[model samples]
Structures are given as C-alpha cells and as structure tokens.
Target: MAFFGFKDIDKLSEVDMAIYRYIVDHDEQVPYMRVRDLATGAHASNSSVMRFIHKIGYSSFPEFKVSFQTENQDLKNSNDDILTMFTRDAFPNDIEKTIKLVAHLMLDADNIIFIGMGASGAIAEYASRQAASLGFNCYAMKDPYYPLVQQLHNTSNNVLVTLSVSGKTIELVEMLNNFVNSADTVLTSITGNIESPIARIGRYALSYNVEETRIHKYYDLTSQVPAVYLVDGLLKELHNQDVARRIN
Candidate 1:
C-alpha cells in the first residue's frame, strides 16, 4: 500500500498491525468509512485508528482518507487520465498566490539556494539551472551534509528553496532547522505534504497534496511532476516580473 512501507509496518504494535491489515483488506471502503467504523471492523478503538493514521505519517483521519482516495483513483486511471484531471482541475488560487509571493522573493534576493535529496535533489538541480539560465544567481545543493548555511555570509539576501516529496527527510529538516532562528533568511518549500516538518519551517510553503508512491519499500516512486509544475510556475512568474520591470 502507498500509505505505509515495510519499515513503517515493522514498527507497528500488534493492535496497530491488526488495524493496518483491516485497512488493507477494506481499502475500497476506507475512504468512505468513519473512524468508528474502522475501529469496529478492526476490533480496535477509535483512538487506535487515529494512532495508526498518525503512525503512517498523516496528521488526521480526513487527511489519511483524502490521500487514500487519491491513491485509489490514481491506481484506477492511466497516466494520461491523471494528467488530464490535474490539468483540468488542479492549481487553486492559494497555489497561485504562493507562486507570486515566491517569485517576488526570488526576484528580490541576491541568491537562490535550491536544496533537496534524491528525486527532489534532481528537481532542485533543474530549478537551479533554469533560474541560472534566466540570470538569477542560483545553486543546487543535493549533498545533505554540505555546509550550505555556513558558506553564506549574508542570510538576508538569500532565498532558500527546498523541494521534498515527503517533507520529512532528516537531512533537509536539519538544514532548515539551522535557518529556523535566522528570521532574515527567506525559506520557501514545495512539498507533497504541507503539514510535514520541513513545510512548517518554511516562511512560504506550497503543497501539491498528491498521493505518494514508493517501490521496494525504499525507492520513492512518488511523482515529482506536481513539484516540477510548481517550480515551472515560479520560474515563469519570475520571468513575467522581469519583463514587467523592464517594460516599466
């Protein structure tokens, strides 16, 4: 299941395991079922159901249900179908607002630092190269242990953009933590889960809220397309701002 991996499953207690199995068995009915319903079906209490949801990285039952429904829908549709739905229905006003705001920050900042690990790292690299092509001083930091913050002398002039699908990567979180007390630095994040740790640290956060997918319990197969779209939007916004400035 997309909800929990083998590592997460091994950490579950007996009661939690029962709840997990119940969820897997009743996957179709889960999105429609209430917490009490799941508790009853799993022979566990409502609190146990809530705890299971938290253990699986979701903050609430509704969040878990929404993610579950999205995952199910994704499985039922082809890649083309998913793309059609996204293009037709996605990109609400809040995302546009965040994009505009981040674009302003990018345009004002003297430097942009894009950081991520693994798949997100690749996305960060793409963003850095794209921004650099447009004449923005940008760097992509894929190395988790790189002393990124220490190398910067002027935090106020730097916009730190972090890309993460989970928003819970230890290295990325640690990197953000270093900047948490530095109010002068503008921290921006694009993540799949907005309520995640890295999201909380960001001064501005944009979440696509897509269903996360993984393979072999370790390889993250979660689509980065949403994040990429956000980056593209940000870059385009930056370009528009530059054009308007030149015109003025």
Candidate 2:
C-alpha cells in the first residue's frame, strides 16, 4: 500500500514490511506504542522497526509520530474551509496567552535579539524595528556580523526571538541550542510547526497550524501571515498594558 507519497513499500524485507503494515494499519495505536511494543506487535525486531522509520525519512520515532498525527488530522479534515482553517484552527485561544508571555519577556529583557533565516529574516527585521520604535533595545540579527555581536553582548538579560516557518531551519536550531545550553537567555520561537526542533527547544513557543499545501514548496505565501498577526496582537496588548499602567 502507498504510504504518504512513498510507493516503494513493496520492496522492503518481510520483517520491515510487516512493521510498516502494522503501523499503517494501526495508525491510532502507533503513537502510543514504544519501539519495543511496536516491534512485538509487528513480530519484528526493535532494530528493524527503527530501520523502517529511518527508511521512511524520519529522524526519530517522536518526529514520525508528529508527522503521522498531523497527516491523519489533515486527511480527516480535508474538506474544511481554508479561511476557517486559518482563522479558527490555526489561531487558537492559546495564542493570546503566548502573546502575553512574549510581551512580558520583551518588557523584562534588557536586550531583544530577533533572528530568522530566508523569508523569516524579513519578518525578524520588521519586528525588531517595530519593537525598537516602541523604545525597546532590540536588534534584528541577519548580517554576517551576528557572531561578533553575540560574542560581545551580555546575554544574561537577553531575549532571543526566532522566527521560522518550518521551525527546523538548521541555523536557527543551532543558534537556539547554543543560547539555551550556554547562556542565561530567554528563547522564544514563532513558527508554523509546533513539534519542530526549534519550537521544542524554545522557552516560549507560539505556533500556527497552517494547512500544508503543494504551493508551499514553490512559494511560502501564507505561512507568515499568522506570525505577523501574533506580533501585531502582542504589540497592541503591550501598548494597552502601558496605557493602563499610566492611567493607574
């Protein structure tokens, strides 16, 4: 049977194919099962199960589970209206809490560093400039001089805002890993995939569930819209809070 877009399943060894068939047939239970349990259920070895996962292009079982769950949910809700999907499903209630948290982090931080790669880099620059205009010490780090600036800056009170549509951008993930492992900095991520590596590593992760489409491969048209909305909402809330504090 065809799995996702891979159609070469028939060529797998008997044990590996058994494991694949078990996973394909028992999609709901697969997520909950450990590697050993899955191996037992498939009458295959644990190594075989792991090998199958690798052959399917996943780095780990958890990552595979995330992709599997997403794909399954998408298939079930394939007919939902696109507008509703973005406005309702993508922008959930937790977004407000996330925005509030981000605003608070920005307020408490001594310096804010916004980082992104490719299209997200533009968003980072825009957000950094906007925050700076609001009297915050912020900089958008996209230049090749980022390493030098980071080395020179005091990172203890720094808040790093990373934007990535995929959340798996190598540069962002590497930066986050370094920041989190070495410094006393706050790491925040805005991304489309919540289960992505960068999001998982972040102290505060705000994600939007944009429906993945074929158009995304050729052009990232709508992925950044929700992120922009989140930033706008956070800025407005911060402004409102400041006005209320002054009034009080």
Candidate 3:
C-alpha cells in the first residue's frame, strides 16, 4: 500500500477513509476502476472519491495512480539516485512558464515580497536576496508583521511570492487568502502539492512533483532543489531581459 504510511488514515473523514480503505484493499483493481466504480466499492460519493484523491496529496486520480506505480517500481528496482529523481520529477513545462511569469511580474511590480516558513523561509530569503542583486526591490518576510505592514501601505503594485512544500501551511494560506480578498496584490506560489489550498489561492502557481513516502513523512525529506531551480531560472531570464532591453 503506497499511500498507506504517507498519510495518517486516522485523520481522514469516514467517507474518505472508506475510499482509502477500498483503494488499498483493491490496489491491483483500483488502477483500472473509474471514479464512480471506486465510489461504489467504497460506498462513498463520487465527490468524496475526488476529494479523497486530493486530500491524499495528489492533484488527480491519474496522477495518484502514476505515483503509486512509479513508487512501487522504484522500490522493486532499488532506484536511489536523488538527483535523477529530482530531474525526472520536476515539471519542466510548468517551470519555464513560472519563470517567465515571475520575471514579468518583477519587472512590472513596485516591490516584491517573498514569504515562507521553516526550510521554505530560508529558500525565500535566499531568493529575495538574489532578486535584490538583480536590481529588483524585493525582500523576504519570514515574520508576519512585515508583510502586514506592506499590505497596510499598498498592495496593488506589489507581488507576493510564497514557497511551501505542502502548500497547506495554515499561516501562509490564511495570510495569502487575506491578501487576495482585501487587495490587488499579485500572488505566486512554488509548491510540491499542486492541488493544495495555498497553491489554489495563488494567481500563478508553480509545482514540482515529488512522490511522498513513509521515509519522506518521517524524515521531512522534501527538497528545495526545485524551488532553487525555479529562482535561478527566473534570475537568468530577468538578466537576459535586462540585457535585451539595454541592447534595444
């Protein structure tokens, strides 16, 4: 059961638990079943099945199935190359688009604010300093007060860049939601969980697909490599644009 140990089964709703139990019990059959079929087997609603998939940290059912297969195959093959895993899992298409978007936003915004906590906060700080070196007026806000002050002053010409592995950090999500509801600030997020609440709130969301397992759950092995890749890419693009503008 790949999904088993990645998520706390006890925390799931009764309907979601039913769906999860059905999937685990019928792991071999689940990959072939339709959403409705799974719902029927679990005695849960179609919506419950969908929600269960997202709740278990997958953007979609197909993605969930693919991750399950990939993880199982990797285990059998004993694939242990971390760099190869990062390269294989990173979403190149989304990465390019996200870099372009970040560059464009930075060019037009009066100020840029990077926000995060924990490991992501450190990444945010590094990204902010990098952006500053590129001549953008940017700063990282690990504390809540600075962002709140910025929000109080002016938000229309500001961009908020948030980083989180789970995309479900309660504090970050609440703050982002407040900004979205109250002002015209541009919001962007870098996260591994594409379907998470903070990811959904961001006007521009960039995601990297890292398969979670029991090891990651206990060890907190979420990598900042993807986020660093994004920031570094964005910086390069911004520099190129600057050079192009000067030449023009």
Over 1-248, each residue of candidate 2 has an lDDT whose tens digit, in order, gives 12466677676888877887787788888878899999999998889988988887888888888888778677658857655546757765688888888888878678888888767888889988888888788888774335733663665678888888888877667666766664668888888888999889888888888765547476766557788877777778766666666799
Whichever of 1 and 2 has more TM-score, that candidate is 1
User: Which candidate number maximizes lDDT?
Assistant: 1
TM-score of 3: 0.61
Task: For residues 214-248, write the lDDT of model 1, one tens digit per residue.
Answer: 88999998878889999998999999998898899
Q: Tell how far residue 110 is off in model 3, in angstroms.
A: 0.9
**Comparison by TM-score, 2 against 3, better one:** 3
- What are the runs in model 1 whose C-alpha is more than 4 Å off? 1-92
Model 3 score (lDDT): 0.79
Backbone clash tally (model 3): 0
For each of the candidates, give the backbone clash count: 0, 0, 0
Off by over 4 Å in 3: 1-82, 145-152, 213-219
Q: List the residue pairs that clash in candidate 2.
A: none
lDDT agreement of model 1 with the native = 0.86
Model 3 C-alpha lDDT per residue in residues 1-248, reported as the tens digit of each score = 35755747767988877787787788777777888999999998888899988887888888888887666556646756744757745674667877787778778778888899888899999989998988888889887545565554654678888988889988888778777764657888888888999888878887888765447455566677887787777778878877777799
Superposing all C-alpha atoms, what RMSD in Å does each candidate have to the true structure? 16.8, 18.2, 18.4
Q: What TM-score does each of the candidates earn?
A: 0.65, 0.60, 0.61
